[model samples]
Target: MLLAVGLAVGLALLLWARRRCPRGAGSWGLVLRHWLARRWLARAAGWQRRRLEQACKDGPRSQELLLLEGAGTPAPDAATFRERHPLTRHSADGTEPPPSPRPPLGLWALLRSCCAASSPLQGSVLYLDVLARAYPEALSPRGTARFSWARGCSLPAAAWPLPSLYCAPEAVGAAPSRAAALYVQLLLALQERALRVLEAGLLSELYDALATLRASWEGLAQDLASGGLSPHLELPQGLRHQLEGLLAPDAARAAELRAECARGWDVIARRLWPRLQVVVVAEPGSEQLYWEALQESACQGLPLYSPFYSAAGVLLGLNLWPEQPEPHYLLCPGWAFCEFLPVEPPGAEGPPDTVPLADVREGQEYELVLTAQAGLSRCRVGEVLTVAGFHYRCPLVGPVRRLSQTLSVRGEGVPEDRFYRSLRRAVAMWPGARLVDYVCAESSLMGASSGACAPHYQVFVELQGVRDLSEAQRYKLDQCLQEDFPVYKSFRLKGSIGPLRLHLVAAGAFRELRDAVGTRGPMARVLRDHRPLHFIQSRVLS
Candidate 1:
């Protein structure tokens, strides 16, 4: 009896040791950590696979993703992305569904229907959708009871919405595999790095990896949410809270993480922010107060960061404004002109003859000059004699009228001389007609007779006494346009320019200009360029 009991005790001890040590048990903590790490890796892999499959099935146009994959390249750049996926060419009306929704469908059906869908890229979209769907527990809204449950599990109550996910051809073009192979590889690399950090028990590295993955996954979730690509998935609150907790112990680290996250969010926001029709600015010397007021007023409750001065610098660059100080020229960084304008001392002003910059106008010549200084500063101002007084307070700023640059169409930058010459020629072609106001736009008139799917430049002319011109005369005017601008002629052949449509406005059109403000005052007079053409004015030709 004593021998049997001793044998039983020995077996129990052996079992306990095996369970604790496993195959590679350097320590108790290492054993537990390894187990948990393995579990997480398996979970991540499963999640990734499911998401990828779903994205392929439900995305706008499967062909885009397929074509990208077939090209076996990295994702294209933004410009190239737009070139390959011309949203304008695809109908937004959604009047019809693709012929073959499935992959194995007939070639003609795929070409005619699938190719007609909204976006071509499918893998990223599918991945996001699947992530959202599979992780509902992580993404659900919280009630008081639910919040308690989440807290018990260390989950967050709120989840950030999915970001806008756009896959550019260039991004894919650079990849070894045209599809999301690189993305998957990146994910694997990140996971491997995270595992290494976990194995070494490097808390800082682990936290950093976790934060990065969290940001990436969150971005993917946001993209899916905004794209409306997948109905099953939502932002994962539980995961977000877990990520938040990872940085809770270190305040400084948390702040840095937050800043990085904010930047990522901004990238998503810039892509998804509802475009504003008008951007206004406050007048010179008042920008600081205006921006402060703006922050205090409408944006106080939001999670937005204070506008930085660098943001202002970028905007100034965009407007072709000089960065250096000049007499009479106020360095105003209003909310309209920049996302953030840091407070700085106004440098010595420009030349004594330097004029207070006048507001922008249509048909006026403007120069974007670079300053001769240690810093290459550029400013966008009206040409020497093209002074037009301020019209109205800018929508972005309360009372600033900054100059606006029209959008560029084609690789050929908008040459001021060529644009003005085109206008002059058009006016000269008409014996008695005087040009009153004009706005030119670079857009794709897709679905038009021209099968070309690229951007085209179109000029909107508001001429005096154009109401009497017959349809035949309108045709003649279009012909004259072809003769006047060689670019226009080339654009016509490329199917970039459409028939020169004339809109004769009531005399009040110019008088009503006072209602519009800022850089927009100039932009309103002339339609800024865009990829898909948007309507500029409500006034229609008779």
Candidate 2:
């Protein structure tokens, strides 16, 4: 049959391709697939850029054509399109409102197309040896061909396809004991696999995962010796049996791991997996506090790498990590049209001064503006970035902070950088303390919960050591704040602003609070409202 002939030809071609690769080079199929994917991605990126540019040019005319191409009436031209649909804010409406203008391209459609162009080769190429060991069959031509059609799930573009244990935050929050049991299972499996690198959505998740391991190791060892999951875990029947298999009664190994854990979790990764190379996280510059905590907590001399930079569902830049002390995002070509707006003063408002991506200069800070086919003419994502240098024509940028993260009380307007610097200095002064995570809120929203009469700043911090601070330790933060900002100091002197109240929460309390509110994604450092602050108020250390 024709099908049989086709299969034979394909097999012959694959074998010939394998022979072409150098001797002892495992398999040529992976290389072929990778190179093909790379080519496909390049083509897709070019097409997407062209489509986005055409959509921007056509403007409202594009939408009219899409909706009424076969209708008798002709679509509006570019001039008519601009005259009829002037650029306006979402809130711009009269008593008798006109229909809101819709983007020529659908946001979700554009996002899907953008995601299609995402190449995972960068993140996975470094782990090819590990992957080959983990999945030899997948490296073969036949297996690769079969897997292309096998459907069940899809991975994020940057994620490596490897054995992973997934735990939903909601599930963990709902059943802590069950989650601990699952973590024990994961650890045992990881011990068998010798997992050397860990990757997660954010650095905080990585820290939380290890913290769970630290808390559950004793129970994990006991379960391993007994060759059973804990009875108290109350896991589902199918999962319980599966987990029991991982606990294969390795008493000596269990004891060794338990002993290593008992020594301390400071170098746990090194002790457990001596080859631990790096911990990779996705969010880089925005989550510096979590990054610091993760570094201290990981403690295996593990370097962290963030492979890509994304904002508001758009991929903007890719990191050239390890080359710089702090990773700078090199703007991704053909992904989206990027612009930078000079960051205006907090209250100063009018049309922003925006510079095209090509004109950006080094060491200057600007608010990032992106134009994509993402259901808007243009979107200023509130991300502030400083251009580090250039990679040819593309500017390398690092995140400063978000414009929305700026905090103001009585028009004092404290910028995020100043607050971060003050907090860093203050934390250094606190004896035996290191900041795990922190959030800030203006006292105006807190009402009596702030325990202050005048407007002030409320800083809630979770610390690794030092359960409670002395009066002097608590005052250090306020002192740092005043030293950093003269306007805040003036307000404090005039009694217009009260002292900054520092609240300490238990180590994992903030994670719990965020999960409880179903905010598993990145949350703003400065909360606009009091609800989340009030939610965590009960858990604050007295």
Candidate 3:
């Protein structure tokens, strides 16, 4: 009897030690482990709800916490990544994917949790979306929510089960999954290593096309100043197609155009164009323009998204965009996910000093760490977000930039979000001009002394419709950039850095970037999705 009892105890310890008997552990390990992880996750959720309830127990208003669990996701501990990088150089055949995010082989199950009953992690659907793509065949949604969860699953390479907001469709490839995956890998490498091709100039034909486009824009900008704006101008068939592709990124013919870019200037002149779409040409206030565009664009289908927006909707009340009034964005509640925090000294780890979420001051930045009912004790997601405001005593925050996106060429470190905002404001100074694509790299400026070169930021911009502007017009933006971000601008003012030069390129520069660094999202993705502006292109803009 004792011998039998000892065997039972040994089995129990083994199951616990093998992370609840995860896949490859034994027969039925995947299914049984997943079940155990789910059970633990439920228990953690209850504990978290209790903690929130306890925190609000003495308040005048009761703290209302909404718990949203994505159907059939592994417990938070089931699967996790140490870091999330942008692009990679992978084989075009799609036979392999960096081995880390390998296509799902078995079920996802949270084997353990560092904070099982300590705190509740919000955004279960967020992780579930990821898992679905990782293991499409295994991790199917148990129930349907009002919104579509796995909308990106239809795409070739970016088939991961992530939400539509988290990915940009322009980067994904078009057909046969492997090729698409390869395209994504190329695009990622291009974006990640943009500096490699910084010195290469635009081919002669490409240069002429840009010059012609600028000439046309010069005429248009002059007309706009004199109050003559056309609703939409007729374009030559070829020019029209290229302009359309640039504006609607996903519309471009991926394979043919990418091959042509390598061929020569003649191919670019034949395949691409000079002109661009005039999105908004007003001095200020583009409300009218946006409304008109929205009216013209049809709502063809209902958008399926993950629970991030749903959770946000729950945290605050659902606020719809004026243009798309049908669907709302929400956050998925429960389960800890990880992101990195930009600490003051930078890159040091171990429990970032965070004020209680209740005590967090608005506009102040803090490292975000989340505890889950899964494997992670506390995970870092490598993002810097700001507390915008409060949502019923909870802080409302939004991501600002990634941890690695800081550029400090002259000891003046400027974050990508900050830089992107300044450039945007600079573009906004002109009416009807569009800032198509941009890349900023550390370039050596002619030094203060002869025979010396100083490192400065060289901002390469591809503006399709905006031509040359007067000193006065450009001067208007200088003040806005300085007043707004001031760090890089201050370096410029102090002569510590050279004037931030903007180099304009022909259309399809960013398209080249998209083709080079393959995107991790679905093809035909939402056009306005967040794109990392730092080094997402490989071709030089001149």
Say which candidate scores most in lDDT. Answer: 2
| Candidate 2 C-alpha lDDT tens digits along 303-418 | 66665776655556666544345878766544555557876655687867567666788988888765544443345676789999876566788888766677888778787767
Candidate RMSDs in Å, in order, are 24.6, 9.3, 19.0
How do the predictions measure up, each by TM-score?
0.25, 0.69, 0.41
What are the per-residue Cα lDDT tens digits for candidate 3 across 2-86? 9999999867755664564322222344334444454454454455445444533422122112112321232332222222222
lDDT of each: 0.30, 0.57, 0.35
Winner of 2 and 3 under TM-score:
2
**lDDT accuracy of residue 363 in candidate 2:** 86
Q: Write the number of the candidate with greater lDDT, choosing between 1 and 3.
A: 3
- Summed over model 3, clashes come to 48
Give me the overall lDDT of model 2. Answer: 0.57
State which candidate, 1 or 3, has the greater TM-score. Answer: 3
